[model samples]
Target: MTFNLETERLILRDLRMSDLEGMFELDSDPEVHKYLGNKPVKTKEESQKIIEAVIDQYEKYGIGRWALINKKTGEFMGWSGLKLNTKMNGITNFYDVGYRLIKRFWGQGYATESGKKAVDYGFKVLKLPELYGITEMEHQASHHALLKIGLKYIEDFYFEEEKIKLRWYKIENK
Candidate 1:
């Protein structure tokens, strides 16, 4: 069964193939995709594959990225949730809280609300020992959200793939 998580103004749920267009729009914004990836998704197929992969991840790992929806209008805003990032150094293979909201929805506290809920879900439902999040050094917005969710900055480094300096934030369940 697909996981459906809700908050006051947002709904986080399994991504559907139909979400590709909206997802592409979100990824296309250079400001939105800046820290997450160096580029926007070039094709609808790429978005579809990514959504399908997220679906598989949810089924296999019991937790994965959830598509963010606007509760008021039922519009696809973006995605936010937890997943295992096996490539990271300190907290590889653990739930990593993340979010990508559209430009229109920026600065509404949706990211923080969703992130807080995600952290609680990791600890209470998934029973994970920790929750972590990563943001580029220049991303003050995300850094603030991390702090709001009780995550402390743990490291600063550059990833070879993105070639960008990043700051890692983490919080242990304990």
Candidate 2:
């Protein structure tokens, strides 16, 4: 299934093969992945595989991370949307909201903007009971954005798989 969502200055849409370059640029940057295990993709093929995996999620789950595009410049800023995070860190599978933008676009409020929209989509459109956001404990920027988008910090716990402590945030549809 195909999807598109718009905010005041961004367009969130399904990932496509044409997004390879933008995805590579976003994923290859060490700064961009600093809070994400600090492991940047080494090749364009890796980015291609990431896109393919998201596409498969769209088919299987009806939702996944959407490409974040600058509506005005038509630039691919990165991606932000909802994902069904299946059992990881001993946490049961749950719907989560996430975002990633180019380092250049880091401080422009794009993450919170798109994240709020994703939360809306999750609750109103998908009818999910709750949504979550997880970030490395030191990622204050992401922590702030998640709060700004309405998620409240619930706990800090160790993710055995990554061997890192993470902050888990959540928001529920009342």
Candidate 3:
């Protein structure tokens, strides 16, 4: 499950065990999870399991979120890519484009940079008919990033279990 996609200043690659520390750092920050149910992972083991699940996703689905590394420093910044979502937000099966970075890496356009590449890979490489994105209603940054990645606003849906309103966006391959 090894693959790599390079942006101008970052490298998007499969999540591996070597990324446990960086993944922990990125996921443990409360600020980074503010819009994500405010649940920052509490242990490195949790991060390890998360990475392992992503690796399994690669084996099962052939694609998943990839680690985002700083090309110049080779530091793991975070993860950005596509994930196969099943029965999410009332959708049976779909590919969702997403990204996340360490708080320090925020505001640096890394998400958008890698996100655009993910969208390109989805359309051109995977030959997906369309791509989808979902963000908390108030996650302005995520909303903007998805739009910038070329997805158009589709609609907003209420996630009953989470009791949250989520905005959905989509882009079709033409």
Candidate 4:
């Protein structure tokens, strides 16, 4: 079944082929990719592939990041939710809470709001023991949102593959 969730002003649901336009709008912006490897998607096909990958994750792992939509405006804002991360950061088979919003939606508290819902789902609904978050070390906005959603700063680690340092955060199911 497709995942669906609601907050005060947003609706979180499974990513679909229909979201290609919005996905492209969100991922093709250079500003949105500044902290995310400085690589914004150059074409709509790349955005299509991304949505496909997330759809595959749902079929394989039973969970994946969901599309974030404005409840009132019916606008596709971006995506947020939990993903099963494997063999990243020396951790295996763990849940990661993440979010990305359209640039215009930034600073509007959407990240923090949706992140909290993802954490709650991981702990309460999925019965996960812990959840993790990774952000570029210099991303102050993400740092604030992760912390606000109750994740504690763990440490900075260098990702050998990406050749960049990142900050790790975590929250236990306690």
Candidate 5:
């Protein structure tokens, strides 16, 4: 399969080693990570490791989170894609849609747009029966984004490692 998927305003591709700085800016924003770990990444080095791990996941899994770049300016806006994370509960434990955008990119409709494309990729193209998504129970924005992308609220659950009340949503191919 190709390493990238393109949308009208975004290019969703696998992260490269050179994307560390952009990744740092995206992952290290406190507000962006608020519903995530409730902490910024702390350093550029941590972003580098994350990029490397994402690359590794692509190599092994064939599908992984993708870096979202603004096609017009070639700027890294954020990332949105699919992953098979077993960590989230009350779901099938496979094929989840996820996104993390820089603070500056918030409220631009990018997350919902990319999420719609990712869900299409997962269900229409990837031929999965359904795709799951998780968000912190308090993350109204993420919950809104997921709903905008056609996912229905499934249930509330907990992930031990994240220690956050989570809600799961699913988009069915049917």
Candidate 6:
């Protein structure tokens, strides 16, 4: 499936192999992976593998994270979109809204902007009943972004797979 979602200053679209360089830059930063278990990929090949996985997800689940681009500069800032999270933290088959931009893009309100768009797409476009956002407890920026985008803090729980405590946030269509 092809997707093209545009916001005021950003564009969300399907991931492509050509985005490898930007994906490498975004995933290689240790700072960017601090909340992601500090597992910064060691090689561009690893980043390529991640891209492959996301592509597979797109084919398998019909929805996955999208490539986030700056409309003004046309740069691959990072990725932000929805994923069909089949199982995580005891939840099953949930639609998850998430974002991750390069450190340079951090603190620029991109997360909130993309997140709100993702949530709207889930509810309005996909007609999902609800959407979820998960973040590490200390990732205050993500926490604030989720809330800023209208997800309510639901609870705190241990993510066994990631081996970390996470804050769960959700918003339902009403």
Q: Top lDDT: which candidate number?
A: 4
* Candidate 2 off by > 4 Å: none
Model 1 C-alpha lDDT per residue in residues 17-92, reported as the tens digit of each score: 8898898888777878877766888788888888889988978877788989989999999889898888875445
Candidate 6: segments with Cα more than 4 A from true spot:
none
Ranking by TM-score: 4, 2, 6, 3, 1, 5
Estimate, for each residue in 44-132, the C-alpha lDDT of model 6 and write its tens digit.
99999999999999899888999999999999999999999889878899999999999999999999999999998988988999999
lDDT at residue 167 of model 4 (Cα atoms) = 97
The global Cα lDDT (0 to 1) of model 1 is 0.86
- Per-model clash counts, in order, read 0, 0, 0, 0, 0, 0
Q: TM-scores across all candidates? A: 0.94, 0.98, 0.97, 0.98, 0.93, 0.97
lDDT of 6 at 8: 100
Candidate number with the higher lDDT (1 or 4): 4
TM-score of 1: 0.94
| Model 6: per-residue Cα lDDT at residue 69 | 96
For model 2, how does the per-residue alpha-carbon lDDT over 1-104 read when each residue is reduced to its tens digit? 78989999999999999999999999999999999998999999999999999999999999999999999999999999999988765668798899999899
Candidate 3 residue-wise lDDT, 1-174, digit = tens: 888889899999999999999999999999998888889999999999999999999999999999999999999999999999887777888999999999999888888899999999999989999999999999999999888888999899898877778999999999
- Candidate lDDT scores, in order, read 0.86, 0.94, 0.92, 0.95, 0.85, 0.93
Name the better of 4 and 6 by lDDT: 4
Q: Between candidates 1 and 5, which one is better according to lDDT? A: 1
Runs of candidate 3 with Cα error greater than 4 angstroms are none
Q: Number of clashes in model 2?
A: 0
